[model samples]
Target: MTKQIEESYQLAKQRYAEIGVDTEQVLADLEKVKLSIHSWQGDDIHGFLFPNQELTGGIGVSGNYPGVATTPDQLSNDLSKALSLIPGKHKVQLHAIYAVTDQPKDLDQLEPSDFKYWVDWAKKEGVGLDMNGTFFSHPMLKDGFTLASPDKEVRDFWIEHGKRSRAIANYFGEELGQQSVNNFWIPDGYKDNPIDKLTPRLRLIDSLDEIIKQPYAEKNTIEAFEGKLFGTGVESYTVGSHEFYANYALTREKLWTIDAGHFHPTEDVSDKFSAFTPFGKGLMLHVSRPVRWDSDHVVILDDALIRMMRSLVRDDLLGQTNIGLDFFDATINRIAAWVIGTRATQKALLMGMLAPIKHLKEVEINHDLTERLMLTEELKSYPFGAVWDEFCVRNNVPVGTEWLKEVQTYEKDVLLKR
Candidate 1:
């Protein structure tokens, strides 16, 4: 199989070189791309902080496929398995609730010390870290509003949590030598059309301003804001619309997150990347799959994903983007979910990187649209999969469905035991 992979890769490389696409450089560049894989998928986001709390704020992780991680060691073990299967060294994204500690601490009172377990693990594994403020599934999420809540106390609780999250992200960066991207996503909105919408947006702006008032070194931690179109309950109006965060990110000089699932079904996030890149600080993409709305299904190598990744590669926006996976589907084996989604994302990126984009762009610039369309359509049938297989082999992971066997073995020997 190894020989077969190398043989196919050699032919594929020759094919790409014929079209002026350097497969070697593409692999090297793709290997440098590190995705921030979300940790909540292993345990459905019911972190150690409040294991019994009912998930709220319109977030849902369906399916009861057994062997959900019940402890820090288990989640870390699951993540380790995932890392081994994935091709490149990547960052692990953690929410505030995933803090590993013996002493109990509320979200508002969380300190960097509480997450020592993760930092230590990251050091041992040689992976980077990213942070998130969990705005859902908390008691303080009063009236389905947090940062934008009319109630002052409710707003205060989340504000403190946000501040603490930044400190933790800074600590992660300091420990791991990578700028921890601290993403803020609040589930604050109204299910029914509100009588007054302006007030909530105003309050949210002020709360966010307060949270980011005390600055940290940009090298240690970068801040971002994510806004959703609508959720299960908040179907009518979401306070943090794309427009809201677009302007906010521009003015505040913060990364604006673009979650693929956070937009209307008809809207494609790929188009916005170019529009935002010229003005905003940068982008943090939550590569996800949405069936009809924000369903948070596992990502697949679909057309939308292809376009988004191609846009990034073609526009040369990779350096200005923080790529991350954000999907939680408990219906399947949790470990397999990570492998499939992450691998699919990598495949999309690989396809994009392999495209003869320079030639295509030149043709377009010369007003040769017909030739541009011809090459692009013909390029789709190229042997990029051979190159992708070689990438996995070089990275020392399974090249194909062979990785599934390892995941199945882990499920039987480790997960089912729980």
Candidate 2:
């Protein structure tokens, strides 16, 4: 595109080549890496389910940003705007609550027809679709549990809902020609200390077994279970803790979903990737920013995120990981939030790909600890920005902060009206 940017990329490419990194192949691989952008960010997690249905089940959104999508059409349109501003082809991850229907129906009653509009939209946009079972913000979760509820009736209802979600995910995969990931994350825990922690986990195991008993084509769907450290009300205990889900996923041969915000502040999710890869079938990552706790702030290009991306690349686990965003920040422009998070993720991946991993690995194997440490720190100051700007230019997106002007224009003409 711009002559100056192209010249800069050539210099950066030669510099990276000296380090045994192929810039062309890295950019090609980055183009193929698809990040599933969450739909909730466009609407502040308010799906078109019911009137006055507040967010419950231990999670909550914390702003009153205008132009929140209240209808399915609006949500789709807003997502399209955000996708256009980001690089590479991507997918939209949808919650079951976002289902558009003509008739009144509950979560268990939802079918692929209710999501036919999404399929049509995905087809038109040349994108894939992923689904999630909405286990929160409903009357069913009033007791702060769903699949792990002691009451058989409540547990059975959620079981049926999970089954339906799998079916929908299968349909999405079949229709879009990409395996749709159906992730299960339920808020089933106690705010205060409880004596019956074992019971709920046992019940959850049975419920999950029952839900998965109904077979769907494996090629069309990937079932994953997400765990939480704690939540708004579920402070004392979370039944779906990391230890529980990690063990269950390994035993059951399912994908393990790791939300960055769903762990202790000091914990690094990147460390868990290698540990889970050996036993688990695959990994699902919910990239989010957590401030002190599971605050679900909008993701920015931070140190932890860059490290996680580098780990995935270094370990060669990118192909086995289903990456998606899971933050809902209504404090700023919603569409801008989506663009910022998605681009930041891509940037991190680019930096990871540009790293001299092979050289560093050789140094480690040779027991040259001093060179290894020095090279690691030295690579950080490389011209990653030049290559990244070239990436944006090659993908036909705005370079640097140029995208912000488009977002501001959209906010003035589109978002402010609401």
Candidate 3:
């Protein structure tokens, strides 16, 4: 090989090693699968989480587990136990704590008793939490989090939870190395009336504002606004539509999240989904498999949006986003559910790695490229799902045949060691 190619190959190996990529072992393992095609070579490619730092890795945890611990102590103990089994490459994803269905008179105020379950849960689990309160089971906010609550008490209650959540995260982060939290599914737009005033929207703004005003808000903590489409007749904050929110009365330094499943989709436009690019800033990513027009959060690489997300991540417009499978599989038990969620994250990591490696292998290349240039004009123009599937097949990774079994083995043999 030429000197330039030899140097590039060595650089790739170094980059892979720095990012904790098991270059020699992975190539060997892929060969053992005995596929006809060769695995891609490691080269002088750069590993990225943001502009400069290389990410060690991340892992994911479920939000909808059954019979989870409720108290702080129980939560702390159980979460630690549960997370001990997962690989450290993924960040913990939470559904956040649910509010009491029928809150008693004295239970009106928000307290640690309700949130301690999650605080201890996160502390012991060694993972961050995804605050998914805007759309869960809160009787008071039946309509939605900030958009639906007509009662002052209800609005106050939501804000209180936001504060409590941040406080717990801040407290835990000082003790731990990382502090992570993201506000997802804010769904604060109108349903029936599209012409509503900015009052309800301001309430949603205040929810995020509460976190920013906190003493530790700016520390290691991230508040990602997850937008979504409301019901059939309802209109809400559409994905890729944050310019209006930025101009709102109570704007702050909040960032946007790209939930793979939440993007607006049609049979025709599914391949061309919008991306989140905040003039090159830290990002929170939501990864899932899309089934049809709606968000099934399926396990298979049914959509190419996953690839689209990886390119943005490679470009340094996003960083350190929590990834979790939001789909509800009625057939699987709780343990099985976690396994499924874990696999989705594993797949996402593999996909993210491919973007830069492919970029580095170009015959003629440019490193100083924008997202539009790198993602569209430079990289393969086809959907990423196809590429991911092709790579798995070529490497004999085995698809659609209970991939979770191999994941379980790897977790036991590799991850649980440390």
Query: Best by lDDT, which number?
Result: 1
Rank candidates by lDDT, best first: 1, 2, 3
Q: Which consecutive 10 residues in model 3 have the weakest lDDT in total?
A: 35-44
Model 2: CA > 4 A from native: none
Candidate 3's C-alpha runs over 4 A off are: 1-89, 98-130, 142-151, 197-199, 232-251, 267-275, 278-280, 316-324, 355-418
User: Model 2, range 359-382, lDDT digits (tens) per residue?
Assistant: 889999999999988877878888
lDDT string, candidate 3, 242-326, tens digits: 4443233114556555455555555222222233333323344545555553434435433354454455445433243333445
Structural RMSD, model 2 = 1.1
- Candidate 3 TM-score, true structure as reference: 0.59
Pairs with steric clashes in candidate 2: none
State each model's CA lDDT, in order: 0.94, 0.90, 0.42
If both were scored by TM-score, which would come out higher, candidate 1 or candidate 3? 1
Off by over 4 Å in 1: none
